[model samples]
Target: METALIEYGNFLVAGVTVNATESTDFAAVWDELLERVSDEQKTATAKLQKVGVLMPDAADEGFTYTAGFIVQGIPAVAALGLTGVVVPAAMYATVLVEGPAADSIKPGFEYLHSTFIPEKDVTPTGVNLEVYGPGDVTASNYRMYCWSAVDGVESPI
Candidate 1:
């Protein structure tokens, strides 16, 4: 496993908060979220790489899932039915996850939270990002980059 550290800023994204758990039908949720993001992008004639952000719920073990895309500027949050999220400037451990979106995401995150951060000398800030790359996105050969905020400059191998 190879890694890169990057300092990324916050973003305004159009998304919905879903109660997601281990048994959730993730594929369905992702399909709708991706489609919604696509529609929002088309309607605005704006574009950016789509992302699925997993934020831990304060009340439950499940996550508050936000599926959307990053906007260059502040988006019309209310008008577009999108919530503004400040990604906050932070360092991240980036890893490439390539394969079908459905299959790749779960294990990718598992590695990040379970193995990557613990094995490296970094602290998880709890904000994780799933960056979708430009390609035949849903295909088995698709590509994505998973980034997790950390507190140190430790090498993420």
Candidate 2:
């Protein structure tokens, strides 16, 4: 498969999330977070939007990730203030991950970091974004778009 380096201008999002060292049970966790969002909708300052992902340092330390984004354009601070969740505001280079949500995209990510990126002489710049769309319809129907920024790529005009 071929991969391209591109830029995402900006986005505004908010939600709740958790972090786990063991591979996460995303389905159950996402559902629970959504429930919290639904119940708190009336008091929320920003709209609850889509789900996302953040990679931890290779060491996999405790509470290394976060969930939620605020309404005031607070860069990467999650609105819910979960222990590890923070919002990220920076340019990113993304790729679409199709197929099962479990490990289907691992190879792609490996290839991007190991092969494509080095060949292009670029370093990772911003947060890696995992954009979840309608594909979460079923256990096997999961689809997520993964993105990472070129170390020195500039913001779009």
Candidate 3:
């Protein structure tokens, strides 16, 4: 349960975006998105790493989910039928979730919101990031870093 405070730079991401609620099945959503972009992703240049951007929905209890890949610059998403998101630079509290991603994300998030953030006394900026690098995602030791944006440092949102 180690947590770290770090600075994240603004970056560009391109992927499938969907409005998700508490009842939504994340695995299904990701599978659908992957099916839509699998081919392009294999050939896409400058595509850095996989990422999941969670932007809180002020109008609902859920968040806007963007299953994407960080790109070196503006990505040509029009042809892929994907949306481009500009993740603003901000300070974040991060936790490394180790294990199969499907099984670890929820618990990781719970820890962040329930214990870590409260202990640090930082206000979440309503934006969260899940970063994944190249690896065997199904491996038991797979890792994903969850970053929660927090107030205090100046951000260019």
Candidate 4:
């Protein structure tokens, strides 16, 4: 489990995401969101990524369920106009998750939030990010690389 700290610029993302744990169909939601952005001719230079604490409902108020965050070349101003969401800029800690993106990724996140964070004695300084790489063709198989920023030095939790 290798970890690294990196700086990411601002970007825009439009997606239909739910806060509750009612077994959401993320694939469908992601497709819809991508379509909407495409229709608007939103040229996304930054790839799609997911970020948030594992079992967010169990975390404190600020921490919660999975939230989608995209990193694009567009600046904050332009991104806000396009996505209608205020995205804050900051550093991030990145970690790669191998295997299927469905349930497997959740365990990785859980480890980060529950075990790694406390073990490392670090707190999230900026928005969490999950970089989705190749292998997401099927529901049962995919790869997701996660990123979460922390104060001082950003490292994998």
Better of 1 and 2 by TM-score: 1
Alpha-carbon lDDT, every model: 0.72, 0.55, 0.78, 0.52
Best by TM-score: 3
| Per-residue lDDT over 1-157 for candidate 2, one digit per residue giving the tens place of the 0 to 100 score | 5466666545544555565544766556656655655446535634434545565554556433334443445433344433233445555555666677556556656777787777777787535655555535345656666666667655446
If ranked by lDDT, best first, what sequence of candidates would result?
3, 1, 2, 4
What is the full ranking by TM-score, best candidate first? 3, 1, 2, 4
Residue 92 in model 3: lDDT: 91
TM-scores, all models, native as reference: 0.78, 0.61, 0.84, 0.57
Give candidate 3's error at residue 93 in angstroms.
0.7
State the lDDT of candidate 4 residue by residue for 1-157, as single tens digits.
6555566655554333445443665555556555545433444423445443222333544332333445454464255333323345556556667776766656665666676555666787535655666444345556677766556554334
Candidate 1 segments whose C-alpha is farther than 4 A from its true place: 34-46, 58-62, 154-157
The predictions' CA RMSDs to the true structure, in order, are 3.6, 5.0, 3.0, 5.7
Error of 2 at 87 (Å): 4.0
Task: Please state the error at residue 103 of candidate 1 in Å.
Answer: 1.0
Per-residue lDDT of candidate 3, residues 1-157 (tens digit): 7788788789887787789875777677667778877575667632568888898766857788888777655536655667888888888988999998878888888888888888878888889888775687778999888888988655445
Pick the lDDT winner: 3
**lDDT score, candidate 3:** 0.78
